[model samples]
Target: MKISAVRGVKDILPEEVWKWQFIESASRRIMENFGFSEIRIPVFEYTELFARSIGQGTDIVEKEMYTFQDSKGESLSLRPEGTAGVVRACIDHHRLQPDSVSKLYYTGPMFRHERPQKGRYRQFYQIGAEVFGTDNPWVDAEILSMLHLLFEQLGISGTVLQINSLGCTECRPVYRKALQKFLRNEQASLCTDCRRRTAGNPLRVLDCKRPDCKEATQSAPSVLASLCRDCMAHFEMVKGTLDLMGVPYEVNERLVRGLDYYTRTTFEILTDQLGSQNAVAAGGRYDGLVEQLGGRPTPAIGFALGMERLAALLPEETNHSRAKPLYLAPLGDAAMERMPLLLHQLRARGIPVDTDYLGKSLKSQMRQADRIGAAYVGILGEDELNDGVILLRNMETKAQTKVPLEGFVDQIAETLAGEGA
Candidate 1:
């Protein structure tokens, strides 16, 4: 029996991976320019790490996480999101002790067991940035601005920023009670999942997508309306900073992100290009996550964008642009025997070069080179070997030139550099 890939997992084949590389590279460049350093954490961690940091009441901890016990009886789970792990790393490594602000960016796969759709996958890749050690709304605005600049650099169109404040610790309790009371009056109209959330995390019920549940919660009290004085001030400052940065955004009062840890300053970058799964990136402030993860009381904010969704936004041709290869086609058995040395020489010079090892005919090798989109083909035949020279052919214009063997590498390097290859 032929085995197929498990459902909801995707294979990003070589033909399509350039898009992912482009997105990742662009994201990293942008983050670096914004003074964010890269941080890498393990794919799996103690299950309770997420349970505590993400809050047990949320769907990620309660339902979607890929949790299991190892043979040693230690319960572990593949991270379902990036923020919890980043926060865990920050606290564990004492990244906040000396600095007033710590900025970090990470890219990796996160696992979940949800029913996958257009942009959602069981094992998906995310590129995220987080800022710890400060609660200033200016930091929040910077995060948003960074996100905007990244998408703009990627040439993604039709993105809209949806912003909201979930209220801080001071006023969320008041909103929670009011939200619960409002949910109770329309209990019958809510979906089963939303009804369950009403008891555990009532704010999450507002984020439910079920049609009946959405309509039922339309009249539910907004957290924005109940923000305490401090939260109100912070929200205004975030807005003012965003305006100063010229970042356009819309106030989405009901945009309580699905995560339970989020408190205040929730935002999502939405695009209609991807059907029902339109949110390309989303995150918010989590003032209590560090404490929950066994650290001192700390405040943090960040955002995570799925690589798959971002790749979908990329143009097909841009994603398919082949990497330039220097094809080394040696004609005759003697030339083939010396091929390895030639390849090594090119590689030592930091050239991306490739050659067929299957002993194909020169014509077949050239055809293969064209198929792989090699930028230049090096022809080393018996005649060229006797003359201590190599024929370098420009694949684009079919132009050929003979260079002495000793100067061949330098000539190739000069041509590629001049062409911006």
Candidate 2:
């Protein structure tokens, strides 16, 4: 058998890399502007970290994790999501110390074992932002605004932000039991996963992606309807703040995000651009998680965006940047001798440059430059070399100019700068 990439993982080819670069670059700009410090955590952690934080019954812990026992007999797992690892790092470093709050952002590959599709992959990248040590609804509103601003900056519109309050510890069990009772009647129609989750993780039944499970839970009890007074008040404050900021949203009763950690105020920003798996970003409040993971009693909220899903939704031809290199075609012994120095100088001065290093014929060199889409070509022959000048030709306009070698570097820099390069 021919060797290839593993079944679900993929190589991001050179041509497709610019789209990813655009997303990562934009994420850093927007995230730093909002004051979220970048956080880098280990790819693999103790398996218990996920089981304890993400919940053992959750599909992520139960099925998707790429887990293994090391030779030391300790079990570890490649993180399936960013939040659990981020929280673990925070607790370990005492980030919750002395009235301190940590706002963190991370972008990298997360591992999972899944059947890959259009926007889902076994190893995928997610851009996540988390705010720790605050329970204020205004913080939630600000996070939502920043997330909205990101999509807007990327030129993706018509994304609907659907918000819901999943109630708190005080009232969640009540809704859970009611949902279990309701789903029990439709048990036969439920998918295998939903039926299995019905007893212990009934709330997750609402998050199931299967068509049968979705239909069965259509009339199931909504946590929004069962929100306690405090939960209701908190939810109201979040909505009011968003309204005051002029952020448009709808109260989606069915928008229970696919996580066990989320509490009061869950949301998923969706678009029809990607079909069934349309959620580009989703997250909510988890007031009890910090303490659950051994940190001090802290409240937190944040979101993770599916970069693959977002990349798929981006416009095929808009604002994609390319490096406009000046390709050099040196045709004589002296011109070739001078080529390397010119290459170094141009690079040092921040001008993008390349040259035919394989000693191809003049015709072949010109063809190579055009094939590589060079914006300008620098042609040096015996006559130009003797005169200490170069024939600089614009590939687009086919205009050539005699540029002196002693003054060439500065002249080309000024010319390219003038052309808005």
Candidate 3:
């Protein structure tokens, strides 16, 4: 039987995982700097959580989510996104206590059941951060500023930040009617999904990526045009703050993101490197979600970076560029006996070290080290055994040192530290 991984799923093999680790490390550093703590939630949650927070009209709930019945007949779903679970966690644990704010970030795999394409996958990875308990426009600006810093640190360039105002409860209905009217006139040109969204979520039609749909709605009414005074002021302040911080952006009036929870301020980080899936990150204010989900009214904004999309734009220098392990190759039987002990002690002290398990010859072992780009190689053989020493060779410089076995690990640690290994 030729069994294989399911369609639209991918395995992040060892050779390719350095990029993922590097991204995760960068995310942690940036998130912590912004006073955001890490938060992890279950991969699956009650189906209604997303259905409520994401709104029943959106595509995520209507089609993409992985929903199923548990053994006890409870309806559950693999989370299609990160925010719903994070907010639910806050409410459940009372993290959003009275007069308290929570800033959290999370990175993990998200499941969806949609068609996979370039820079788009059914099972994709995302790193997202959320700030709860503040409705200030500066909060939105701060998040955008942090996002800019993240991209700068990551070496991603030429990405565009597009901003918009989705209005609020008071003014959105008016825009909805305007958009619904326009969509009706252009109904024959919309794609099937946009046609369906017209009746359920007319605003989502603005987010449609179909060429015909975009052309049809080229002159469609703008959400910014319908922004109420409050939303207009909020959007202006957000842009003003971004300008003050020297963060660059464009007012993309047509940028209605794919989610239903956004309001007031919405923005997306986009790039032309990826063909159709141009948005690498997108987020906005969701002022009513917490209260709607049974918590006190709170305001929040966040953005999630798409790993696959970002990977497409990242330089090759980052892939498999992690500092390599110290490869220990035993030359003879005595060296073999001592191999396990030295390996264990080195690993115990948090050094990455590996040894030959196949009993390969010195030449073959060195080849393996070269294959893995080991920073150094440690050799234990007859001469070293008699003298209570081991030979360490710098793989890159081809420099060898005979160090006493009494403090072999310490000596190697010092050498590696010196080399920034």
The number of the candidate with the highest TM-score is: 2
lDDT digits (tens) for residues 347-378 of candidate 2: 88999989987778889988988988888999
User: Cα RMSDs of all predictions?
Assistant: 2.3, 2.1, 2.5
List the candidate numbers ranked by TM-score, top first. 2, 1, 3
Once superposed on the true structure, which residue ranges of model 2 sit more than 4 Å away at CA? 185-193, 207-219
- For model 1 the TM-score comes to 0.92
Give the residue spans of candidate 3 off by over 4 A.
Answer: 185-196, 208-218, 349-351, 386-388, 396-401, 404-407, 410-421
- Cα lDDT tens digits, model 3, 1-421, are 9999888989888766777777778879988999999998999999999999998877799999999999999999999999999999999988887667789999999999989888888899999999999889999999999989988877889899999989888999899998899899998999998899898878778777788998999999888878899998999999999999999999988888777888889999999889888899899999889999998888888888998887677777654455688999898787899988898899988889888887899999999999888988988888989989888898888999998999998988888788775
Model 1 has how many clashing residue pairs? Answer: 0
Cα-lDDT of candidate 3: 0.89
TM-score per prediction, in order, is 0.92, 0.93, 0.91
lDDT of candidate 1 over 96-186, digit per residue (tens): 6634888899999999999989998999999999988889999999999999999898988789999999997779988999889999889
2 or 3, greater by lDDT: 3
Give one clash count per candidate, in the order shown. Answer: 0, 0, 0
Sort the predicted structures by lDDT, highest score first. Answer: 1, 3, 2
In terms of lDDT, the poorest run of 10 residues in model 3 is 314-323
lDDT of 3 at 335: 86
